[model samples]
Target: MIVSLIAAVSADGKIAQSAEQSSLDWTSREDTRFFISKTKEIGTVVMGRKTFGTIGKPLKDRRTIVMSSRTGIEGVEWTSEPPADLVARLEREGVTRMALCGGAAIYDAFLSVGLVDELFLTVEPVLFGDGVPLFRNGARINLKLLETTKLGDSSVLLHYLLLK
Candidate 1:
């Protein structure tokens, strides 16, 4: 299966300034619109449990899958840490491609396992002094350029093919 990572970060690579999910408000309108557009390209999306917790709900008009060890979450399919089984289930469901919209840990997990196919990043203008890094514990991985587009006044989206 082909997988991709999509996210927006500050100039210095911070996903958010604080633990408050609402703190992502610093992200630009153009970036958000681009992200929404990208989502329409795929029918299913895969995200970490923490990301779903931050967002509060599944995105409409798409089948959302959440990776988590526990259950009882509404509007989401719970998954376990060893994603091998979860990935098999997804394949059985005929999911050809998936995107990773994250909170860092998920990125690390997928990257470490060599599952990511592409990386889509929106670089914003401003930078917070300190905050959550995009790939907190992810090991170094190489990528080949796929596409790049500029957005608004000070934002750009860079797409790269993940090198396994």
Candidate 2:
């Protein structure tokens, strides 16, 4: 399976000011458009419970999977399985592509298990001073830059291949 992680962070590498705040409020419009377009293309998005809560609902034309200990979430698939198991199951089901739509812990879990193959990041121009870091407990892994593109006037999109 081709697993990709997509996120927009502040200049200081924060996803949001707090758990209550949405990154969409501060991220650039170009990043938003890019994210939406990519999600539409990929079709399956996996995110943590808190991240799913912030979004409020499942995205259109996509399968939403919530990686959480708790269950019974409506309109989405809820699983407590680790990232590797989840990826294996998806592969068995013939899902060739998936996206790690994150808050933080999800990113760490996937990266820790060496499931992330690609990373797409949008670096916005603003600074949050203190906020949620992109990868809270992720391991130090190397990456090779695949491409970089300017988004709008300030933000820049960076695509990298995770070095195994």
Which candidate number would show the highest TM-score if scored against the true structure? 2
- Pairs of residues at least 3 apart in sequence or in different chains that clash in candidate 2: none
Off by over 4 Å in 2: none
Give the alpha carbon lDDT tens digit for every residue of 1-164 in model 1. 77778988888988777655653578789988887778768767888777787787888877788887787467867777465666677889888877788767787787777778898899999888788887766478888998889999889999999776
TM-score of each: 0.90, 0.96
**Quick one: how many clashes does candidate 2 have?**
0
Most lDDT-accurate candidate: 2
Candidate 2 residue-wise lDDT, 76-151, digit = tens: 9999998889999999999999999897889888988889999999999998898998886645889999999999
Cα-based lDDT for every prediction: 0.79, 0.90
